[model samples]
Target: MNAPAIDARKWMPYPSAGGAPTTLYCLPHAGAGASTYLPWRKELQPDVDVVPLQPPGREMRMRDEPFENLTPLLNDLLAAMDGVWQEPFALFGHSLGALVAFELARRLSAGEGPRPAHLIVSGRRAPQHPSRLPWIRMADDPMLLEIVRRLGGTPDEILDDEQMRQTVLTLMRADLGVDQTYRYRPDPPLDVPITVLSGSTDSHVTMAELEPWAECGSAGVDIRLVPGGHFFVVTQRETVLRRVRHCLVGSP
Candidate 1:
């Protein structure tokens, strides 16, 4: 069966020349679009094809409602990725995207399909570990604003505007619901190697919280520390890109 076509607006493709053995499929954090990785494509070597996966309900798919659960989201993504599983591919996801990548990898490995060569998870704790904070099920307007403030990813201009805030808040609530409802089911470590990235000052996730990612994979796991808070990728782009490139092409 042919794979379903992904919403073009959601996914940003970075094609590469031949002889590049690996393709890196990047998944964005909640409330973000594929453009988040636009800079990485230019910074990385020519051989790696950096294809950023854009989830629905954002950017060009702004008209579509955001997903509120993991199962449906992963199922749709797996379908979209159907025909493009030929080469050695790796999965990279940040925060919420990290959880999706790990779960998707599990689904792919269980099915009669090729698995990603590596899983690069950033800014998220391991699945087996429960979140440190209690779930925020229903946030009032003020609370929502505070949550967004603490996260520090949403733009202040958008959050301040009534119309923009409404649109973003709708998506944010749905994304948070998905995150809150998520219950990690433990399983044996994967054969693929996993790399975890964490920020030294990220209050949401700590070095200890990120270390358990080593148990998620059998081959081995490596952790890299960047110098910033939760949104380290934005502040330390060069350092993050350097680490990613090294992992993708450096001596094994």
Candidate 2:
């Protein structure tokens, strides 16, 4: 059977000059749409095209139910990105999106498509590292609320509203399931270079967890600490953009 179709019309593009040799595909964190990267697109050099992936369950596709697992979601995303691989491309993803970017790189390497020239992961630990917290699959309402409270991304309005809270909480639970249930199988390091970014104050991920990214690729690994907490991308936009531009266009 064929995989389900993803609605690509939801994706928004921040196009660049025609002569650029590379495209940077940015993926959003869980519950986030492509709008997250719309601001960064302008900050990048004119030669770098920024394409943000808009997954189901958000924005224009808010009516569609979110995916309960990563496998199906990734399949849909790869399909949505099908014909847009016109140039040497790189990927930048934050938090949950970082995991998606990593997995997508693995898939592209195994598939017939052009492999990404670089992978930029932000606000997430390496896949090989074990999570420190207990799996949240069995959490009750109070427990889930505590987790969400500590995580600090969900807005207060959503937390207070019954309808919005249910919608977001359901999506969060499924996304956390995908993250917790995942097990990294040993594979040879990727040929493409990897650059990992994390916030200095992110309580969830330790330095040890971030270091293991070096093991994922054979070419080279660069890890940097930025300001702010898990949502540092929002707080440190210019610095993040500078580092990303340097990685993609600068030395190997």
Query: Which of the numbered candidates is closest to the native, going by highest TM-score?
Result: 1
**Candidate 2 local lDDT, 163-250, one digit each (tens):** 8887777777766767777778888888889999999999988898998999999989999999989999998888888888888787
Residue 105's C-alpha lDDT in candidate 2? 90
User: What lDDT would each prediction earn against the true structure?
Assistant: 0.79, 0.80
Candidate 1 lDDT, 218-252, residue by residue in tens = 88898888899888988998888777777877732
RMSD of 2: 2.6
**All candidates' TM-scores?**
0.90, 0.90
Every model's Cα RMSD, please? 2.6, 2.6
Q: After superposition, how far is residue 5 of candidate 1 from its true place, in Å?
A: 6.6
Clashes of 2: 0
Model 1 regions lying over 4 Å from their true place: 1-19
